[model samples]
Target: MQSNPGSPHSDLTLAARPGAARQARRHVARVLPGWGMAGLADTAELLASELVTNAVRATAALVAAAPGEDRPPVVPPDRLGTIRLRLSRPGGRLRIEVWDADGRPPVPRAADADAEGGRGLLLVAALSAGWGWHPARDGGKVVWCEPAGP
Candidate 1:
């Protein structure tokens, strides 16, 4: 994580592992309040965790498809690169973004009630003030959401 105490922006890049989401949640939980956006901490942490989890899953999917990539270590220590979580206040509104190597846009699904997952983006859409995604220059896509008003 790279951030200054009163800075308006902070960035964290973590290995694409199962624990990455939890790390992201902790990052958001701290950065938001440090930036005087404590009101957004809960929502930001939740949304950041969701996006990071999705990114990790996408990375793991590719890893699981490779010949010997199905190793014990979840991320294999940088084999699949990292997931970046960014927090910024654009126009005074808190914006959270997660970047991964997946270029395909996120698709919201109507999850079965009995499903154990698949509600990440749904929760994001319901909780965020506005959200979207754009292709990143580094070859992936950055999914972003605004949790606070302008």
Candidate 2:
């Protein structure tokens, strides 16, 4: 979560939890007030949901692997441990960035037409204007997408 020293639209971090998704939507709403973009809130909420859900699941796996004092829900405290949500309005797009504590990038699984699971990233691809991932210096990866223009 490195930020440009003087950039106002630099970086923001939010806890990774089920409820954090809703909080993220609220944050986006507050930040982009009067944007009047239809379905923007829903898109943001859905993206937040998918990303946070994945992060929580990954954290649980890490906790199970390392038995000791109850590890915090997020992992790799100084590195890949915390989930990071970065919202930026640099150009004509609303960028939603979700960072998780895993260096291995996420692969969007192809779901069968009749399948009930493995559709989160598919939804992300369908809704977002564009989406992709990048490796964080600290061994985690940031998956991000841009919403349709306002």
Candidate 3:
């Protein structure tokens, strides 16, 4: 886990596991008391769930691509790989960033009338003021979205 030098706020890192996502939700809840941002607690949990789910799925695909003998270590239930979720209150807005080791950028598809698997990012875009993805220097990618109006 890399750290940003001279940054005051600490970043949260979790393995792409289901339990980790839950734990992250709980942690965010606990921290919300200090943030004092109305309705932010629920928003944090929802966003975390969506982002973690995507990370886990991507990690699973990567593991499956590797040779049987080179597969990754045992991942926790509902978790697939390493993911970093960072929350920062640098100024007026809350920045939510979810990073995974897969370098592929997510392609947001237009959901079919009856489709069930393509709505996560759509929800994110709706709730967030703005969102985008970029490749990380270490071979993975970071997808970030900011809440509207701080």
Candidate 4:
């Protein structure tokens, strides 16, 4: 796990792609043990995957909607945005923050039981103590959540 220099948080910046969610989960698995919260690692990793998956989908949509104009591309031609996963401890609770270059906040949709998708935020709301989002000063947004217990 790579710790961010000059900061108490550890972060992983991933390309806004399908693979990023897996990478984010792996990162959480590696970092949380050192923070002495190994017991919470499974829950944390699950929540992180859900959040990162949503962020990646949102970012891809944003890039597709706007091919040009100010939204910096993470790579040439593809116009992919960056997804940042940050881990921090505040007030003795683990804070999971996923930053993406999409201004739209996540909305939990009521998916049918047979639906194959759209349950990300539902899992988040169930597993997380609290979750919400706010627009970033530089544009885009950060979706954050904290698990219910130790």
lDDT of 1 at 78: 53
Whichever of 2 and 3 has more lDDT, that candidate is: 3
| Per-model TM-score on C-alpha atoms | 0.86, 0.71, 0.76, 0.86
Query: Which of the predicted structures, 2 or 4, would earn the higher lDDT when compared with the native?
Result: 4
User: lDDT for every model?
Assistant: 0.81, 0.65, 0.69, 0.83
Better candidate by TM-score, 1 or 3:
1
Residue-wise C-alpha lDDT for candidate 1, range 1-150, written one tens digit per residue: 777767878999899889999999898887776677787777788889998998898766765666674433243345357888999877888888888776668888889999999999999999988899988775677899987432
Ranking by TM-score: 4, 1, 3, 2
User: For model 4, what is the error of residue 94's alpha carbon versus the real structure, in angstroms, after optimal superposition?
Assistant: 0.2
lDDT string, candidate 2, 1-150, tens digits? 333423334344655556666666666655544444344767776786676666655554654566675443343556444576776666646777877776566778888999986888888888888988987666667788886545
Q: Which structure is stronger by lDDT: 3 or 4? A: 4
lDDT of 4 by residue, 75-146 (tens): 334334688899998876889999888777689999999999899999999999999999877667889999
C-alpha positional error of residue 145 in candidate 4 after TM-score superposition, expressed in Å: 0.4
Name the regions of candidate 4 deviating beyond 4 angstroms: 4-7, 66-80
Give the candidate order by descending lDDT. Answer: 4, 1, 3, 2
Better of 1 and 4 by lDDT: 4
lDDT of 3 by residue, 1-150 (tens): 322333434367787666767866765665555665546778767776677677777776776675675433343434346788877666756667787777788777788989977788887888888888988775677788777643
Judge candidate 4 at residue 17 and give its lDDT.
88
